[model samples]
Each structure stands twice: as C-alpha cells, then as structure tokens.
Target: MPHDDFQLPEQPRPYVQPPLPPKRHGTGWWIYGFFAAWICLGALISNGWSINFMVITIVVTFVGTPLLGAALFAATKSDRR
Candidate 1:
C-alpha cells in the first residue's frame, strides 16, 4: 500500500452565527399594553351582552390582563432604585 494513495480528510470549519440586531429596551410592556388595549376595545364593542361575545370578552380579558400586568410589573421592577 502506497502512503500517497490515501489523501488526508479536510478539517471542518467552526459554525459562526450572524450578528443579532440591537435589543430594544422597554418594548415588552408596549407590546403587551397594545394587546391588552385591543382586548378592552373588543370587550367594549361586545357590550350588547350576547352569550358568545361575553365568553370571548371574558377569555380575552382573562389572558390579556395578566400579560399586561406582568409587563407593567416588570417595567416598574426594572426601574426600581
């Protein structure tokens, strides 16, 4: 067997990720507040009090209110002295 007959395998290069965009501070609260506001608007529009609309309003309020509250809480917590 000739040594020159077998060529050494090429080395693999390390994986590199592209640079990420800069983070936006305090954006979470704005997003959560936006959704929460939409939910409130929906509830207001459904004030006719139909059963289905009432259920939807309740569900959205249940979910959105907590999310908005959490975001607001986080924003305030981050601002503490």
Candidate 2:
C-alpha cells in the first residue's frame, strides 16, 4: 500500500466529559457529630455498660446515622426546590 493512499475522516468524535456528582447540602459533618454525641451520651448513661445498651448504641450509631443523614439531606433538598 502507498503511504498517501488512505484519507483521514473529516470530522473527529467529540470528547465528552463525565457527569459530575450531585453537590452535598454541607450538613454531613454536623449530622455525624450529632450521632457521635448521641452514642457518647448513651454510654455515659449506661455506666454499668449493659449488653443491651451497648448493642443499641452500636446499632444507632452505625445504622441510624446514615439513614438520618439521608432523610435530612433529602428533606433539605426538597425544600430548596
């Protein structure tokens, strides 16, 4: 094949930028702090450190925090619209 035999396409494919993530409402830190405080308060109240209290605190801190944060964020975002 000759060096100049092939012709380049006239139009090149457009470059596409990936979509950006949705902006946070900026309350994440506060929500986390609130949940941490709740856990600490629970510990303080449960001086004897019963198993049930410990389990409750663990569940609330780990599972409840994200659920509460999501609910709060959704509520705030919805209000903005």
Candidate 3:
C-alpha cells in the first residue's frame, strides 16, 4: 500500500490497567483495635491505681505486642495467597 493511500485505523487501542491492592481486613482491624484497647486498658489499670505501672507496660510492650504481631502477620500472609 502506498504511504498516502494507507491509513491507520481510527479505533482506539485496547488498554489494560494494573490490578489494585488487596483490601484491608481482619489484620488491619485487629491491629488497630488491639493497640487501642491496650492503651485504654493500660491507662485505666495503671494510672492512679497501681505502682506496678512500669512493669505492666514492659510486659505488654515486649511480650504481648510481639505475640500479637506475629499472629497477625501469619494470619494475613496465609490469606494473601
């Protein structure tokens, strides 16, 4: 076909968009709720109530937080696939 005689089709090209990220669910919600509950409970339990506040905080932060995080991570990771 001659250059002048040949014309490209006027139709639009087909396009595809990338898939969106997975929606947040049990993990996200559980994390937020757990943290919030801890803070509120800690405040109520320690403030003006006991002198063992520091010890309680340490145990919760070091032991509880890690356990909770690990559980959430495992649960979420499995759900991903």
C-alpha local distance difference test of each model? 0.60, 0.69, 0.64
- TM-score-superior candidate, 2 or 3: 2
Across residues 1-81, which tens digit of lDDT does each residue of candidate 2 receive? 554455444445344212212335366576868777977878887775798678878877888788887798888667645
Least well predicted 10-residue stretch by lDDT in candidate 2:
16-25
Clashes of each: 0, 0, 0
Report model 3's TM-score to 2 decimal places: 0.51
Instruction: Give the top-scoring candidate (lDDT).
Output: 2
- TM-scores for every candidate against the unseen true structure: 0.43, 0.54, 0.51
Q: How big is the positional error of residue 52 in model 3, measured in Å on the Cα after superposition?
A: 1.1
Give per-residue CA lDDT, model 1, range 1-61, as digits (tens): 5555454334443442222122234545576576667666776788765776667766777
lDDT string for model 3 (26-73, tens) is 456776677667767777787754657656756776688779888878
Alpha-carbon deviation at 25 in model 2, angstroms: 5.1
Q: Which stretches of candidate 2 lie over 4 Å from their true place?
A: 1-25, 48-53
User: Quick one: best TM-score, which candidate?
Assistant: 2
Candidate 3 weakest lDDT stretch, 10 residues: 16-25
In Å, residue 7's CA in model 2 sits off its true spot by 49
Alpha-carbon deviation at 61 in model 2, angstroms: 1.1
lDDT for 42 in candidate 3 is: 75
Comparing candidate 1 with candidate 3, which one achieves the higher TM-score? 3
